[model samples]
Target: MERPQNMSIAPRIAVGVIILFHAVGLVGLSLPATRPLFLQVVPWHLLLMLLTIVFGHYKLSGRFKAFILVVFWLGFFAEWIGVHKGWLFGNYAYGTTLGVKMFDIPLMIGVNWFLLVYSAGVTMQRSGLKNGFVRVVTGAGLLVLLDVLIEPVAIKFNYWQWIAGSIPLKNYACWFLVGAVMLYVFELFNFKKQGIAAPALLITEFVFFGALNLVIGLWPL
Candidate 1:
């Protein structure tokens, strides 16, 4: 199924605005003192949720919708458990970026997980790959690959501080595992349809976050 003929612009603008803010955040974090403020607002994953919603509105199959939501929630739970146990993503505690928390897990953090996994799952679905196993494995791998760049920058800005010298491989491996499971679950849920609206939504997020970073650089707040 292709995208609906009557898509609205509001979602597009919402995504654009979110990206704009993130770009500003990136720049803001460049300043020594104001950096924390910028880091606080850049929940890079929220845009992913917006993207998922957009995909849904565009008429993604019910199975894909459930798949996106479930995979993300799985990651969300995993992150919460792993962070508390010092088994996943390291023992770094979250800062105000996610607001106040319980068990060292912020509610917004779970929201972020949902968005990230949802977007990733949709992306993998559209990659034209034939083997379900290969798609699931590769999709998870892609997420971990993206995380390799995201983790260091996040740590440097004090979004979260790792007690260890560096984030461990186990942390990334866990992410891959969760990602794979999510993808498998999505497939199991039955997402054979061809329309998910991920391309535009993800592109929007990339632009939003990237631009937010740029604006933050310019304004330093």
Candidate 2:
């Protein structure tokens, strides 16, 4: 069956609710009185965000499921190596604010990688960019850009810490490389694009983190 051009009301409402919830949460986080309570909710927030993306891809084909699995594992492994060996993403380590972890990498990192690549890939596809290489590269670029926004906020929120009190260039380089490969795999799988959740979540994250970065001004920089 062909995908609908517009998202259905159910998914749209879900996305709207998530956005509103996060927007309010961010506001709460900005105040010292609510900051602790907001930090405690960070893990659940990440889980809910991942759930929104999954809901967007509901009823998708097995190929898409396989794609998500591969991306998730690859992302986890990359982070595992980065945290232990300091290879892919430079010498950085996650903090407790993100909640539970395995192998010193927060489980949410894997989910985040999948969500970012999927959202970026769908966005490129929606942009009417027909060339596979262009789509992959552009999507990866977008991922890197998002990371630029997230890095500072991450540090400020104690989600992760960098070795030298600054984000390393290699970290962004790794993001671009891995993001490109993941988006390429997304193109290879040819997953059908449906609903507004992907783009909405992506844009929401961008604005959310971007605003945080602006307001916080890169702490410890």
* Best model per lDDT: 2
What candidate 1 gets wrong by more than 4 Å, as runs, is 1-22, 31-36, 43-57, 60-69, 192-197, 200-221
Per-candidate alpha-carbon RMSD to the true structure: 4.6, 2.9
Candidate lDDT scores, in order, read: 0.61, 0.82
Over the stretch 1-221, how does candidate 1's per-residue lDDT look in tens digits?
33345444344554555455555554566667786555556554455455545544544456545655665567667767776776666676766565656667666665566555556666777777888898788878876776665665555555576777678888788878877777677667654443444444455555544554554456543
What lDDT score is found at residue 50 in candidate 1? 58
Each prediction's TM-score versus the true structure: 0.72, 0.91
What's the distance in Å from true for residue 144, model 2? 1.0
Candidate whose TM-score is highest: 2
Tens-place lDDT per residue, model 2, 1-221, is: 33443323357666786699779887877776888899888888878877767756746566767888999998999899898998888998899888889989988888888889988988887888889999998888889999999998889888999987888899999999999998988888887656667877889888988877766864332
